[model samples]
Target: MANIVSYLAREQRTFEEEPFNMVDGLVMATLAYLRYERYDRLPARPSEPFRLHDVLALASWRDLLAGSWMRDAADSRSFLRALMASRRYRDAFVSFYVSESSDAVEKQFSAITLTVGDGCVYLAFRGTDGSLAGWKEDFNLCFMDVTPSQQAAVAYVSGVASALPGRIVLTGHSKGGNLAQYAALCVASDVYGRITRVCNYDGPSFLGDPSPRVGDPTYRAMLFKAVPESSLFGMILEDGSDYHVVQSSAMLIFQHEPFSWLVSDGDFLYRDGLTRTALWADGTLDGWLKTRTPEQRAQFIDTIYDFVAASGVKTAADLHRNFGSIVMSVASSTAKLDPETRAFILDTFKALVGVVGRETAKSIDPRTRIRLPRRRESYDGSRPADFARSLRPAADGSQLAEAGKPSHAEPDGLQLAGAGGPCPAKADGVHPAKADDLRLGECGASLPVPCPSAPSPEASPAACGGVLDKD
Candidate 1:
């Protein structure tokens, strides 16, 4: 009966056409969470196969895309209305990975809410896939690889540019920003002229020293980058896009959801406290394993792969939940670990959680102690770590950044970091407070600023060659 219910929910929600939106995001998030929570309670052996959550999540996500979320003029009030309208956002996101193709195996993913504002659509696929399969996967609201995803994104926006008969705007979460930039690059001469700007929220680092040009030059000309003060994921990318660094209350750095910026009725204003801890445990775990004898790192990765392979869960959500449980056991020191391996296991687990907790904090409600909005006077865009580092902690544990730092004017506004790669765009211009900016951190905030703008790749500073900085 439970299986039937799950099947029906997934089937009823499948996306077969266009017009996706936040309703899809809600469904995907729901399925991902549900499948993650229950993967372990099912059969543990392949022969006795446990139900897969990936398929279900994918189905729900696709269904959301079939709606009209991607149309233009979409706003936060409408987005939230859509989210609240659904009962299962997490599940839909989790189940988005049930691909039957061999080609899409290696790619990062996201839901793209185009400027058209139909709502939203999950754009998932690997960058490595060739053009044929790539073209088939509805570049509009489907998964894709890095290269192909960029291509499709460009086409979508170029179409918008052509159709609008004027300038077009593009933005996305995570890899979506990368795609947006790629689209800007790919836009045709006439179409490119119509694109106004691009915004990327903490997307991954762009690959290549002589960065590969994927979209139109005009498109690249109008790109911007935004991230949380203590960003983890987006910081890995380069410093080319227009940048903005958001202040957040959620601890564990990455949790800075731009949407959380506090807003009052019409004005997006905020007042909250934010803090950062090294997540020392997170810092050393994986890298330590990698640093171990090369053979040890290889062995560690293999061991984890084997463990998951043996766990019977077959979907993305299932894998996440199962791996999470396994990690939790490692963190709690509750698993029956070997005498020689226990210390390593716990250390790795702690590090993993701290890192994920920081990133996940922006959207997921992992229990947190503090939350703050960016002070209008404090809107000088310094990195959060820099912000925290500048100030001493009060006895009450509040951070005191640059005393009498009477808020300087927000620089050309935007973007962070150390520990990872070179922290991009330190202080770019930040506009008036945004309503969404007050509630969500950078990753989710929708500031009412000019569309994104970017520096030329040829002009972008080279990756400090071979030295990936830490967060």
Candidate 2:
């Protein structure tokens, strides 16, 4: 039942008393998601560092500015209120807030520096916001090593490191976590030497070799990577840094939201490693990425971006306003893609599903049965059903939440948790050639599978049921 809000509210100990730990790192990283730039009282670039208490005194949850654009805006506003009222963080200070969203370069970057108790400094980079541009940057990470955001992060860390004197920690959730690590290594030696830790909370790793910016051999010691047991975005591409899994209360992709992570007396509930499904997913994804050349990645990614752009929606707010129009725009756009690009999308999806299906069969107990929800064919052939409405299993009971609107704090897709009776044998004249033809998602029962947008089977677990079902 405990989360960061409750933990901080009850916490009387200062940073000096308790010292910084995984929990503190997670907390700071989560705070980075707040639209700090929109809060005018917080110091911006070239401005001297401002005390956290002073800023909180002037700012209210009403002016936090997450309400219009951020996913789960209400929860985020409440979280900020908790932080502002916390006794533990009164000594913390903030400065050098920067945020940029540019469609021309397909980049969305934001970072803030928090100097706490004159001892520890956190350079917190934000992950994807509601912007489609933000999501595109995440896609860019799949092919490129150093994103524009990463470069900005490096500069941000270097610019503020000397001015803010402390034992520095580069920290963030999602792509922000990726940025933190990237900034740590890429900064000058003086700045790198001051960094005591780099906390990456469920961030993706580089697809290509990041050149000329490697830190000293000590970076491995500085790393503290934690991902949920059923991580998807965190497992993208290939990662060499060791990471441990943490238990999450929520299922599947929603686990990427740090708020869903389960906490104990003073720390996160730890697991040995990723779940069987996650391991299979990461391996499958790495294999899939390794097969494609960088050129192919760029070409295919551009095609996908085109579809998103065609929707004419910019941010999560826009998504909420015009869901129907956006869907229509995306569907029409998909049909206009060159034949080769269309083939690539379909061929790639089939191959990935085949691999996941084979893995599921091998990994699970064939005797067990999993009842999956039926698939309706409303998706544009290019769009997957995984991004649609989901009936989430909440703590109290079932609740409805929209999928693929952007995550609460990271570069993760919204989860589509559809649990129901059984699949219809016929395709409803919508999707003629389905993955069910390949026997893609079942153990023994012949359920007609409706395809979900799974990079691996793990991405959309509820829709593609069988081996990954918890019950």
- lDDT to native, each model: 0.35, 0.64
Name model 1 segments beyond 4 Å from true: 1-79, 82-104, 107-148, 158-165, 186-190, 209-221, 238-242, 253-258, 263-310, 314-316, 324-471
RMSD of each: 19.0, 17.0
Q: Write the per-residue lDDT of candidate 1 for residues 182-284, one digit (tens) a residue.
A: 5555455564444444556545444322123334353344555555555555544243334555444445542433333222222222223112332222232
Q: Candidates' TM-scores? A: 0.38, 0.72
The digit string of per-residue lDDT tens for model 2 on 1-471 reads 777667777776776566666777788887777666555655433345677666556665555545333345335655666777877788787777777889888888887777656355677888878788898899887666567787777777766654555457788899998888777766766766667778888898765435334334567666778899999888775344578789987788878888778777778898977776776676566656655666677777787677767667677677779878877886677677788877887776676776665444444432223322345534557656463443333233323333433223111222234533322221111111111111111111111222221121111211111112121
Error of 2 at 275 (Å): 2.3
What overall lDDT, based on C-alpha atoms, would model 1 receive against the true structure?
Answer: 0.35
Off by over 4 Å in 2: 42-45, 60-62, 65-78, 209-217, 316-328, 366-471
**Best by the TM-score measure:** 2
Q: How well does candidate 2 score on lDDT at residue 349?
A: 65
